[model samples]
Target chain A: MKVELTLFGQLADIAGRTKFQLQDIPDTDTLQKKIHEMYPEMANMSYSIAVNKKTIHENTVFEGDANVALLPPFSGG
Target chain B: MSERKIKNIFSQGPIPATFIAESIQKHSSQTAIGGHSIFLGQVRADETEQGKVKAIDYTAFEEMALEKMHQIREEIFAKYPITCMHVHHSLGQVQAGEICLFVFSSSAHRKAAIDSCNEIVERIKAELPIWGKEIMENDSHQWKVNK
Candidate 1:
C-alpha cells in the first residue's frame, strides 16, 4: 500500500523534501527498513514514527493509506 | 468556571512583551486569582565551534504538538489547583534574547501557581515535538537537541 511519508526537522534536511509517497510499503518494520535503505544517513539519526498522528512503539502492520511522519529530536522551549 | 477548550499554542514569531503584559492586565478582574506565575524562554546566543549562534528557527509537527499540549494542559490542571494556564511557543525565527516561549499559570495561592508553571515548562521541553535549527552568525545552521 502507498503511504504518505512526512519528514520534520533535520530529517527533512536529510531527505531534502518534506513529504513523499512510499509505494508498496508493507508494514512499519519494512517501512523503517525501506526508509533506511533509501536514505542511509537516516540510519544514523534517532527519530520516531507517528502513523496517523499516534506514535508507534511496536511493529504495526499497515493495511491502508496512512499519514506517516519521521520526527527528529525535539528542541522547543 | 467554564470549560476550557484546546487552544492553538503557536505564534508565528517571537512573542512580544506587550502581549504578555496585556495578558496580565486582562486578568486583573479575576479577583479569585491571588497569585500568578510565568515562564519565558529566550533564545540564547551560544558560542559554537563554527561561530556564535544568531537565532533559532523553530518548526514542528503542529497537529501532534497541539494534541500533546492539550493532554499536558489537562494533566497539569488535574495535578494542581490552578485557576487557568496558557502556553505559547514561537514557530519561525526567534532572535537571541527574544522570547520563544511563554507559560502562564494563575491560582488562589502562590505555591500551586508556581508548581504548575514549572511543571508545564518542563513538560513542554521534554514532550513537545517542536524542533529548532540554530542559525549561526555566519549563516550556518545546526539542529538543536534539548538537554
Candidate 2:
C-alpha cells in the first residue's frame, strides 16, 4: 500500500521537507524502520506515529492508502 | 452538560490584548457567570547556548489538536460546573513578552472557574500536538519542550 508521511517539529527539520510518500509500508513498525533507515539521526530521537490523525502506541496495519504523521514531543502553550 | 460544537482555538500571530478585552466585554451579558478565570501564556526570552530567544514560531497538527482539544473540553465540562469556556492559541511567530495562549473559564463561583481554568492550561501544555521553534537573535533556532 502507498502512504503519505508528514513530519512535524524537529522531524521536519531533519527531513528537510515536511511531507513525502512511501510504498510497501504495510504497518507502523515497518514504517518506523524505513524512516530510521532513511534518516539515521532520527533513530535516537523519540517521537510518536499518528495514523489518520490518531496517535497509536502499538503497531497498526494500514488497510489501503493512509496518511501518516511523525510527531515529535508537543511544545504548545 | 450541554451540547457544544468542536471549536477551533487557533489564531494567526499573537493574540492581541484588545481582542481579549472584547471577549470579556461580550461575556458581560451572561449574568449567570459570577466569576471568570483567565490564563495568558507569554513568550519568554530564554537564554540558550546559541543566543537569547527573540521570538517563537508556533505550529501544530491542526486536525489532531482540534480533535484532542474537543475531547478535553468535553471532559472538563463534565467534571466542572463551568458556565462557559473560551480558548485562543497563537499560530505563526510571536515576539518575546507577547501573549501566545489565552484560556478563559467562567462559572457560578470562583472555585470552579479558577480550578477548571488551571486544569485546562496544564492539559493543553501536555496533550496538544503543537510545537514552538525558538528563534534566536542570530537566526539560530531551538525547539521548546514544556516542563
Measured by TM-score, the strongest candidate is: 2
Worst 10 residues of 2 chain B by lDDT: B1-10
Chain A vs native chain A, TM-score per candidate: 0.95, 0.98
Q: Look at candidate 2 and tell me the lDDT of residue B114.
A: 100
On lDDT, the leading prediction is 2
Positional deviation of B115 in candidate 2, in angstroms? 0.7
In model 1, the runs with Cα more than 4 Å from the true position are B1-3
lDDT of 2 by residue, A1-77 (tens): 99999999999999999999999999999999999999999999999999999999999999999999999999999
Model 1 residue A58 distance off true place after TM-score fit, in angstroms: 1.1
Every candidate's lDDT: 0.93, 0.96
Docking class of 2: high
TM-score of each: 0.97, 0.98
List of clashing residue pairs for candidate 2:
none
